[model samples]
Target: MLHKLNLEHILFLDIETVPEYKDFDSLSDELKYLWADKTKYQRKEDFTPEEFYERAGIWAEFGKIVCISVGFFSFKGEERSFRTKSFFGEEKEVLIEFKNLIESHFNTPYHLLCAHNGKEFDFPYIARRMIIHGISLPQKLNLFGKKPWEIPHLDTLDLWKFGDYKHFTSLKLLTHILGIPSPKDDIDGSQVREVYYEEQDIDRIIIYCEKDTVAVAQILLRLRQEELLSDDEVISV
Candidate 1:
C-alpha cells in the first residue's frame, strides 16, 4: 500500500510540547483543581498533581507546543532528498505557521500527513491546540465528519501494529529494530519538558522533533522495502 503512494505527497512531522505553565503554582486555583481532577486516574495515588506536572505536556489542554518540525521528500530525477523545517517560539505562531504550510502546499486530497503514533497523539494534539487558540483548522487536520478512508493522514505506528491492537511500539524502539539510526540519541520525549522549561533550549527540542519526523519517514521507507535515507539526503532548511 505504501509503495502505491508517492513519497513526496507525505509530510512527516513531530511536535514538542511543554506544560502550559512552568510550575504547578503558576496555574490558577480553578486550573489546579482541574489538573488534579483530570489526572486522577493516571496519577492513581502514586504522585501528587504537583509532582506529576512535568508529564502534563502529554495532555493537550495542559500543554503548549513549543516546536513543530516537519520533513518532506523531494526527488530530482534519480536522486531523492529529505528537507526539514521547524516552527518554534510562541505556541500560536508555531501553530499558525504549520497551518499555513498545510493549507497552502499540502492541501490536496492526495497529500498526507504522517507521524509515529500520530493518529493517537500528534494529529489530535495539533487540532486541539489550534482550536484552543481560535485558529481555524486546516483541511488536513479537520476530521469532523470524514470517513476513515477520507482522512488524509497516515501513521507509521498504526502500520506497524498490523491488526495487533494490543501492541504498542515507540519510535526509538522501532527504529532500532529496523536498523535505522536512533532518533532518541540526544533526548527523549520524557526530557522535552525539562529542556524547554528549565534549559530554555528550543533549538535542541527542534532538532529532536525533526529527528523523530525523519525517523517516521524512514520507517515508511523501510516498510516499503526501500533503502534508508543517507545523511547527505537529509537537509535542514
Candidate 2:
C-alpha cells in the first residue's frame, strides 16, 4: 500500500511547543489551579504542579506551538529531492501560516499529513491549537465525521506497530534501530522548552524540527524499501 502511494502527496512534519507562559508564576491564579488539577495524576507526590509545568507543552491547552517544520518529496524521473519549510513566531501567526499552506497547496482528498506518532500527537495538537486560536481547520485536519479509513493522516509509529496495540516506539529509538541518521544530534524534545524560553534560540529549534521532519520522510522511504535521502537531496527553504 505504501509503495502505491505517491510520496509527493504526503507532507511530512514535526512541531515544537513550549508552555504558554514563561513560568508557573506567570499564569493567572485560576489557570494555576487548573494546571494543578490537570496534571494531578502525572505529577503525583513526586513533583509540584510548578515543577511539572515545564511539560505543559505536551498538552495543547497549556502550551503553544513554537515551530512547525514540514517537508515534501519531489521527483524528476528517477531522482528525488526533499524540500522543507518552517513556520515560527507568535503562536497565532504560526498557526495561520501553517493553515494557509495546508489549504492552499495540500487541500485534496488525496493529500496526507505524515509524522512519527502524528495520529496521537502532532495532528491533534495542531488541530486543538487552531481551535483555541479560532482558526478554521483546513480540510486535511478536520476529521469531524470521517470514518477511520477516510482519514488522510499517516503515522510512522502506527505503521511500525502493525496492529500491536501495546507496542510503542519513540521516533529517536525507531530511527536508531532502523539505521536512519539520528535527528537528535544537537537538541531533543526535552530541551525544546528551555531552548525557546531560556536560550531564545528559535533557529536552533527550527533546525531540530526540520531534522525530525526529514527523518520522518526517511522513515517512510525505508518502509517503502527505497533509498534513504542523502544530505545533498534535502533542501531547507
Candidate 3:
C-alpha cells in the first residue's frame, strides 16, 4: 500500500534553475565546465555543454534559486485537490515569498517533501536559497551531510534503480512506462526562461510547473506502487 512509505505531510515539488551570470569569466575552467553541463538540461538542440552555458545561463551563480513550484497534495481518501504555488523572478524576492509560503503552512500536520530529482536538485536548491534569504529551512529538509537514502528524501528518480545507473531516465520516460498521460503542451524546459523573459507570461510557466508537478506525483506513485492513470491523459511537454 502507498501508506507503507508512511509519508504523512507530503509536499511534492519541482524547481526551475538559472545561473546568475550568462557567462562568468571569474569561475575556473572546471567549475565553468561543471555549470555548462547543466545548461544542456532538457535541450533537444545539438549543443555542446560549453555552448549550452554560453548561450543560456543555467546552474551558475552557485545558489541562485529561480522558480520554486511547490505542489502540496494529500493522499488518503479518494477526495483529492492539490495546492500548488510558483515563485519566480529575482532570487531574493522569490526566496522571501517562498520562505513565507513554506513557513506559513509547514507546521500543519504533514510528513515529507517529495520530488523526482529533488535530492540532486530541488531540495538543496530551495534550502540554499532560504539560507541566502536568512530563512531557516523546514526541519525535515535540513538533511545536512546525510546520505540521501538515510535522509527523509524519497527521490523518485533514485527509486527507479532497475540496475542501470547509467540509464538516462526522465519524467517523460517514467510517464510513458507508467502509462500516465503527460500534459506538457509541447513546451520544453529549455525554453522556460525565454518564455518567462520574452512573453512575460506566468501562465505558461504555471502550466509547465503543473506538467512537472503531475509528473512528480506520477513518479512518486510509481515508486510507492504502480502507475495508475485513467483515460483522457496526454503526453508531450
Candidate 4:
C-alpha cells in the first residue's frame, strides 16, 4: 500500500532547535517567570529553573529553530536520487528562507511533508517560530480551517504507531528495528543546545539535521518494502 504513493511527492524534513536565549540569565524577567511556570510539571522538584533551562528547546514558545534540513527524491535519467538542502543561521533568516522554499516549490495539493515526529513537534514548531518572526505561514504549514484529512503532514513515528496512541517510538529506535543506518551516532538532540551556544557549530547541526531527514526517507522506504537509496545517491544541494 505504501508503494502506491510516489516518493517524489514527499518532502522529508527535520529540525534542530535551541533555547531562544543563550542562558536563563539572558531571558527577560517575564520570560524567565513564564518558563518556570510552563515547565512546572516536567522539571524535577529539586532542579532549579536555571538547571532545567537546557530543555527549553523542546518548547516552541521558548525555543528557536537553528536548522531545518529537507530532503526529496528526484530522478536523473532512470536513476533515483535524494537531494538535501538546509536553512540555518539566525532564526528569522532561517525561517524566511525555509518559508520561501515551501511557498515556491511545495505549496501544492500533490506534495506532502514528512518528518520523524513532525505532527507533534517539527511542523508546529516551524509555524510558531515563523509567527514569532512575523513571517507569513506557508500554505502547507498553516492549519487554519483544515480538517485532519486535509492536512498534508506525515509522521514516521505515527506510521510506526499502527494505532497505539500510548506507544512512542523515537526515530533512532525505528531505524534500529528496521535495519536502517542510525543518524544519531555522533551527537543527539540532547547535546544540540550546548553545541550551538557553546561550540557555535551550525554546520555540525545542519549535518545532523540532514541525516535525520535522510533517515526519515529511508524509514518510509523500508515501510514500503522498497530499496533504500545508496550513499552515492544522496546529494547535498
Residue 215 deviation, candidate 3, in Å?
1.7
lDDT of 1 by residue, 1-237 (tens): 789999999999999888999999999999999999999999998999999998999999999999999999999999999999999989999999999999899998899999999999999999999999999999999999999999999999999999898999999899999999999999999999889889988889998999999999999999999999999999999
Q: Which ten residues in a row have the lowest lDDT in candidate 1?
A: 193-202
Among the numbered candidates, top lDDT falls to 2
Local distance difference test scores for all models? 0.95, 0.95, 0.64, 0.92
The weakest ten consecutive residues by lDDT in model 4 span 1-10
Spell out the clash pairs found in candidate 3.
9-110, 9-111, 182-234, 184-237, 187-237
Q: How much does candidate 4 score in TM-score?
A: 0.98
Instruction: Point out where model 3 deviates above 4 Å.
Output: 6-8, 21-50, 54-57, 60-63, 75-78, 107-110, 145-150, 162-164, 225-237
Query: How many clashing residue pairs appear in each of the predictions shown?
Result: 0, 0, 5, 0
Q: Which stretches of candidate 4 lie over 4 Å from their true place?
A: none
Model 4 lDDT tens row, 37-112: 9988888597789999998999999999999999999977789999999999888998999888887888889889
What does candidate 1 score on TM?
0.99
List residue ranges in candidate 1 displaced over 4 A. none
| Candidate 1, RMSD to the unseen true structure | 0.6
Using all chains and alpha carbons, the TM-scores for the candidates as numbered come to: 0.99, 0.99, 0.71, 0.98
lDDT of 4 at 53: 97
lDDT of 3 by residue, 75-188 (tens): 548644455677777877887776676566654534567787776777777777677677777665677786655575666776676666676577777778877777565676
Ranked by lDDT from best down, the candidates are: 2, 1, 4, 3
